[model samples]
Target: RKLPGAAGAADEGAADAIRELEEQLEQATQSLRAREEESKAAEKRGQALNSKLRRAQAALAQARAEARRHAEAGAHQDQELRDQVASLSSELDRARRKLKRAGKRHEEDKADKAARKELQEDFERRGTELYKMNDKLREAVERADLLGKALAMQADEVEQLRKHVGEADEWRAKCDRLSMAEAAAAVG
Candidate 1:
């Protein structure tokens, strides 16, 4: 009876050990499955990050290219502006020369106008003097004509007086002859 009871007790202990090992194995399997799901989630996140990094790199390259293009265009525009400034400066110089010439011409014209005015005044003065001289000459001619008429009248009066004197002398001679004849008759 003692031997059979000991064998039955050993058999019960062995059955309990087997049940504990199976429970431990099931827990280990569940832990392993949870770890696999976590690893797959981490791998998907890494792939998404890689895709974003590639896109960012491409955007940076395109931005650099655009900046270079803008710089080249700005340089060309600066050169064009310099050329325009030079052209404008040349035109300004030409305009200044033309203005200087015009100013000199204006001064010459003013001088000519002053000379013409002086000549006109001299001509007017000479004309006035000539008119006065002509008036004086006309008056002198009128006086000469009057003097000539008076001299002609005086000559005619002198000739008439001489003829009357000649007649008086003839009469005086005839009277003397008659007296002499009367004296001679008385004596006879």
Candidate 2:
């Protein structure tokens, strides 16, 4: 009877151990399932993070490319601006030269105008002198005409006086002859 009682107690202890082991195994399996779920969540989060990182990197590369393009455009604009400035400077120099030439031409025109004015004044003075000389010449011509008329009248009067003297001489001769003849008769 002691041997059977001892075997029965050992069998009860073995069954209790087996029940405890089964409970531990069930708890471990539940814990492993929870861990596997957590691992899957972590993998999804990592993939999301990698996708976000790739997108961020792509955006950064695009931004860098845009910045390089903008920089190149700015350089091109700067070069164009420099060319424009050079062109403007050249235009300004040409304009300044043209202005200087125009100023010189204006001075020459002023001088020419002054010379023309002086010539005009001289011509006017000469014209006035010529008018006065013409008037003097007309007066001299009128005086000469009057003197010629008076000289012609004096020549006609001298001719008439000479004829009267000739007639007087003939009459004197005749008177002397008559006197001489009367004296001869008385003597005879």
Candidate 3:
């Protein structure tokens, strides 16, 4: 009497665990999908960033060219001012001094341009490293997707086994009850 009920409870517990595993497998699959989407989005971002970086490099080159032209114009202006100072002798030595300062500023601008070029090279190197990192991340996501599929399959197998066990337990209980009923009827 009570033995059959105890057996049924044990079977129910096993069935419940199998159900829980199935639910967990579903959640894992959803998470794997999310990771795959994130990987794709990361790839898109890297591409966009690379495109923008290329445009920025082109703009920097244009700016360097404009700066070179401006420096050349300033040098021509300095020469003209120097000739005027020579003719005017002492009236505008200050103008000649200003022209010298402008030349020094052009030297500083050359140094700045060199530094900017170095920075651009560094940025390109860093971008390449970032792309490699993203590749590894995408690979990790793919592996996780495979693992989720395997886990889902295993969970399904467990669920099927649980169902079969539950059916067998039910049939055993029914047979026991039927035999007991028949024995009691014969005794009566």
Candidate 4:
């Protein structure tokens, strides 16, 4: 009934489990590293997109500046005015779309600010409540400690009273024995 290998079986099982855990940990580490690289790539892409957006905005501003220069250079040219009119029409459409997007972004920003403000207020309120609860808990613990000390003192007093009662009983027993002996002697 006693297999010698049975003792090593438990150790072998534990070793296998440790090996499997090590493999799992290695896989998790690799996965996390991959995700971190992906996150960095995404950040780069976002920065590139923002850079392109800024370049496009600068180009639009340059176009407007150029149009102003052209108008100033030729007040009497009918052809320039016609070209300017067509360009202005196209610019107006793009400007309208940009304005709409800006308005939406502004509203979203406003809502985000409100949410953040509410969250901060809630955190402060909860923190105040937590502090108050902590104070009450401390006071309760102090009261318990004081009561424990009082109880210990009372217990000591009770023990002393018990000792005194034992002594009194011993003295009474001795007196009774002496009285019985004296009465017997008198009778004799």
lDDT of 3 by residue, 1-188 (tens): 23377798977776676666556555655655565565555555555555555555555555555555555655565566556445544423444466567887675555556655655675566556556655554555555455555555545554554555455455545545655554454344
Q: Which one is best on TM-score?
A: 2
Candidate lDDT (C-alpha), each: 0.52, 0.55, 0.55, 0.55
TM-score of every model versus the real structure: 0.43, 0.51, 0.40, 0.45
Where does model 3 exceed 4 Å of error?
Answer: 1-102, 185-188
lDDT of candidate 2 over 119-149, digit per residue (tens): 5675566556556655554555555455455
Candidate 4 residue lDDT tens string, 1-188: 33368777876776676666556555655655565565555555555555555555555455555545544434434445456556655655565567567788675555556655665675566556556655554555555455555555545554554555455455545545655554454344
Model 1 C-alpha lDDT per residue in residues 78-128, reported as the tens digit of each score:
565456556655654555566567787675555555545654565565556
Question: Which whole-number lDDT from 0 to 100 does residue 79 have in model 4?
Answer: 46
Alpha carbon deviation, residue 155, candidate 3 (Å) = 2.3
Clashes in each model (backbone N, CA, C under 3 Å)? 0, 0, 0, 0
Can you tell me which runs of candidate 4 are displaced by over 4 Å?
1-103
Q: For model 4, give the 10-residue run with minimal summed lDDT.
A: 70-79
Model 2 alpha-carbon drift over 4 Å, by segment:
1-3, 102-188
